[model samples]
Target chain A: MHKSLRSTLWILIATLGATAISIIAISRGESINALWFIIAALCVYSIAYRFYAAWIAATVLAVDSTRATPAERFDNGRDFVPTHKWIVFGHHFAAIAGPGPLVGPTLAAQFGYLPGTLWILFGAVLGGCVQDMVTLFLSTRRDAKSLGQMARDELGAIGGTAALIATFSIMIILIAVLGLVVVNAMKHSPWATFTVSATIPIAMLVGIYMRYLRPGQVLEASALGVVLLLMSVVGGRYIDEHDNLRLLFDHEGLTLAWSIMAYGFAAAILPVWLLLAPRDYLSTYMKIGTITLLAVAIILLQPNIKMPAITQFIDGSGPIFGGKLFPFVFITIACGAISGFHSLIASGTTPKLLSNERDICMIGYGGMLLESFVAIMAMIAATVLEPGVYFAINSSAGAVGSNALDAVTKISAWGYPVTVEQMENLAKQMGETTLFARTGGAPSLAVGMASIFGKAFGDGLLAIWYHFAIMFEAIFILTTLDAGTRVGRFMLQDMLGNIWPKMGETSWTPSVILTSSIVVAGWGYFLYIGVIDPNGGVNILWPLFGIANQMLAAIALCVATGILVKSNKLKHAWITAAPLTWLAIITTTAAWQKIASPDIKIGFFSAATDLADKLASGTLPAAKAAIAPQLIFNLQLDAWLTLTFVILLWIIILDMLRVCWRCVTGKPILPLTESAYKPSSLLDDWVRD
Target chain B: MIIKLKTLWKIIRQLSGDDAYEVYLKNFAKHHCNHNNTDCSTPLSKADFFKRWQDEKWQGIKRCC
Candidate 1:
């Protein structure tokens, strides 16, 4: 039997075995034993990674083994990063894997542990891993072209232009939604807010020391930064206890939004040698170390997965952001399981660092599989909480019933009942006024983790455990925030430079500041609205983010399909084309549903109409009426975003058709100019020996 | 029709290698069509023309060719 065929069969058996066991356990009303399930999952994943992943890495990927990495051939101290294959793999994995895997899966567990887990596992193997690997391979072959450029090259000029537009728009929406999640988590927690807020100065101090005093001492600087960051977390407890300090840090949501904007501007304007580089380095370390520790902790603790498989909230009315399990779970767990944004990174940054083509499997496919496991851990963390507490923490007051008393009543009416007394007791235990409407998945997951860690470490360490969880999430989220801001700033400057050449230069301080402010304000506006939203921003912003991210994936896949067809690998094109078609269908249907549905809670168009009706009937209160215009505008914006995605997808499809026609008829297609860098003869062996 | 499809597929596979397939297609088109006009003598070129073809007010032949 062929080795590839045999290995593929084993992977199927393992995956099916895991799936069958999980289904039977859930159906039989047996408690999900975390240790057993995790072991089983890891065993299966390891086999897949070792046998199947390696085979694909060697053959299907067909990496040119003879070529020497850039580090060996064109080693530059700066951007031309040269490192060992394993080190590069580690760095890439650490950079991409963040709190996304942890937070998304935990929240999506509202559907059922089985559904969320299966999606993470299956989605990673088929959709996410394939997207990442193929994008990396394509980009590497094209001299590390970006996702947008690849789309244009394979699809044609029109597809490429549309992809760029989609990318820019998606970046804005992603930053805004993520910013909202952070603000909501920190809103009422002065200790968390202060500690996280302190990281800025800590990063700057480390940044200065690295730049001026100890240049090239990344390891040393990061070590100092991590220690200081932990100290700041400890220090936050004292600040929270102090009345004056607490008052100073405890600003309202809108005020916090402004502060974040100011921080983004400052961070962007500073030289990379300063805060940005040091913070990125420290964040890189913290993200990797903390996620590993949490995973280990979960494995060692082996806590029971207590939450029911399916919640009563499956009717698009569940608390922590509305929408049923079928679509929303797929959307909520977007980045961790499969994200279009990763395609951007795969093409933009990682591909540029590829030393060997074979490494693509490890960095792309293996990295995504690791992220999926993180999501699985997040699911475990979320499900461990008592159902009543989970409901109280995740449910918005408006949706859970309306008002506290009503919320309690309605929740008690459900199978997993919670009394007012029970709610108060749980809130007191968790040290919060009302756990209701803490829409950000981070806080609830933190609280649950704290309980687990508290039990393991000792009762007295609960506070430390809580802050540790906060610091872990903050490190990842802040990394994303700053990195996103810098990327956005650069993009804006590039666009502006096209109009006024001087504005494009990175060294121009005035232009840098102007572009930075514009970029910050773009995402900041959305963050501000999300913060002020009484209905919990997750309800509105998450779906938008999900759709946008998915659309980017569709674009990426379209580009890949076009390239395959152009290369006359039509038989194999379906490997990418199939996923592309499915994503298009999913995104289009979701967008259409979002636009057409009359429910103000689900559909943007219907929501707009509902608001207008309320205004005309004079039934809305003055305060509600004031916010009505904003809601209506938001609805229209949603529609516009949907339209943009549709147009981008179609443009790419048209480009693919053109490319296919060209190839089929043996027409001359213009190829881009070649790069100067040459691959070693060793690397050429696999491709052309 | 089947033969044509098979021939087209073969041409596509050959084109995947290099631009030599373009010359072959051009010759094949000239033999079949019996036209001296460069624009009409080649199916491959016709395909390129149509792919790049735009229906707009500012369309320019120089910009394309």
Candidate 2:
């Protein structure tokens, strides 16, 4: 058989085999036995990676075999990042696939493992992978233009501008929400907080060393940083034991918010060489190593997926966030399964690094598949926990089916029964005051992971194991935050410069600082809100973030569809167009529901109106009344967000129409560039031979 | 906003009556400006102004006005 055919067959066998096994296993009333399901998933994923991904990496990506990458092609000692493809792949994967896959899947698991798992598989294969691959291909063909530019070139100026605006807005919401997750995880855990806090100086030192002492020695510097970070994790436990240090670590939410803002500002202002670069390197290493360990651990442990395939919480009354499975599943598993953010990465960085046209399959399609697996593992981790504990950990006090007794009663009613004593005992084990409404999925996942790892590594290492999990989660999230900030700043400066040209100059220090502050402030405001919300902030913010992120994917897919149509590949365009259409429908409907629905429990706009009614009625008690106005304001804020997404979607649709018209009329599209491959003479020679 | 609208209407009527839109815009500034002093007149003729307004100037005016 031909190489391509063989590779394709291998992929189909692996993927279809896994699908068949999962279906059979679940159908056989063995929903708890996840071992076969996991093995099937891994085997299929491995085959996909080795053959399908390799095909994409070689043929579909179409990386330039002749010229070295920008890092090699134009080695200006800055920004032309040239690293080995595998290493770069690892870096990209680490950067893009962070706590998102973990948190999203865990939260979505409330609907049952099946809904989340199916979404991860179907969404990645049809939607996420296509978005990443096409964006990468387009950007590579256009000298690695950013997603915003691709939108403009293919869609039009309106589309491009809207994409940029949407991207900037999404970044703020994303970082802020992720920050809230961290804050929640560390809220009362002095040891975890202190340990994560110490990573800053360590990142800085590594940055300084890399820049001034051993330039280009990223591997060595990162290795050293990792060792130091691990030591800090160990040391943090000691500090938490000390009374004075514990007090410092136990800073209030307000204090933590301010600290995070300060940190974001400082990190933004600092040179890339100091904090961002080194942290990215370490994060890259930790992200890859830890996820691999988690995957291996899950398979070896063969833990049962105790959670059912579907739950009664499909209504917008889920414990983690109030939303049904249909829209919420797509929203919760945003990045792990499909993320708009990945489009930016595909267009911004990965495209320029393509070594051959074929590399697209691996970098674009395969990278996303890997992220989906991470989401799968996250589902496993969250579901494997005792059902009552899962509910106790995720449910906020406001939505915990009312009060503690009610909460326990309701959770116990759901397949996993538990008593108040059990909840308290588990909380004690995890070293927290209350596990209820601790809605950052990471800590619960950590607790779940620790349960498994503790059994395997022995119970004595539980605390260390717990902290290790914290560090892993922090590294993934923090890298995203820092990198996201930098990208946001650049985008802000770009927009500012368009309005007033001088602000665009990278060297204009004051302007740069001002723009950076504005960008940081945008996301910072959301983070502050999340930190302050009495209910777990993820409930509101994650869905909003998910909407924004998916909207970006919609935009990207529209652009790709346009290009494919222009190339007279309409039949093939559905590969991207179908998913694009689905996302557009999903996002548009969800956004409308969020804005129009009158239920305070679901509709952001309606919630605001309800809050106002409460404030007007004078029914709010004196102590709680002060927060009423803020709640009202947040609801209105959410309405505006929904409106923004609606507008962005229309812009992309208009752009797509324009591109389609141009293609029909044979008008030259903007940003038109030549393909990288010239039907290589070497291939011809090989054919002849 | 009113002035621009009136000017646009006048130009449209004149063009529909005789000259084309572009030609009317070209000749309007030279013949029909309130100042009638060539030096005081802006370089943008009626047609040029309409085009510019449609693309860029109108958005600014609409935003502010």
DockQ of each: 0.01, 0.01
Predicted structure with the largest lDDT when compared to the true one: 2
Candidate No. with top TM-score:
1
Q: What TM-score goes with each of the models?
A: 0.85, 0.84
The lDDT, on a scale of 0 to 1, for candidate 2 is 0.71
The complex in candidate 2 yields a DockQ of: 0.01
lDDT tens string, model 1, A465-575?
777777778766776776677777777787789899999897798998888888888888788777766777777777777788888888888777777766667777776
Screening candidate 1 with a backbone cut-off below 3 angstroms (N, C-alpha, C), the clashing residue pairs are: A66-A682, A66-A683, A67-A682, A67-A683, A112-A309
Fnat values, candidates in order: 0.00, 0.00
Candidate 2 per-residue lDDT over residues A1-689, each given as its tens digit: 99999888777777776765667346633556666556655665666567555554455443555533333333221233233345446545654677788888888878877778778776787688778877877776676677777777766788888888878788888888888878878877888888889889989888777555764344566678999999988888788778897888987766877788788888777766677766766776677777788777776777777777677888777777776667778877887777887887787666544444445666677778888888878888898887778888887766665367888887787667878888777767755556676777888898888877776667777777778888888876876777677767777777788899998886699987897788788888888777666666788898898899888888888878887777676656677778888888788877887888776777987777776888899987775478778777887888888888888787787779777878778887764443443332222221112
- Please give the TM-score that candidate 1 achieves against the real structure: 0.85
Worst lDDT 10-window in candidate 2 chain B: B56-65
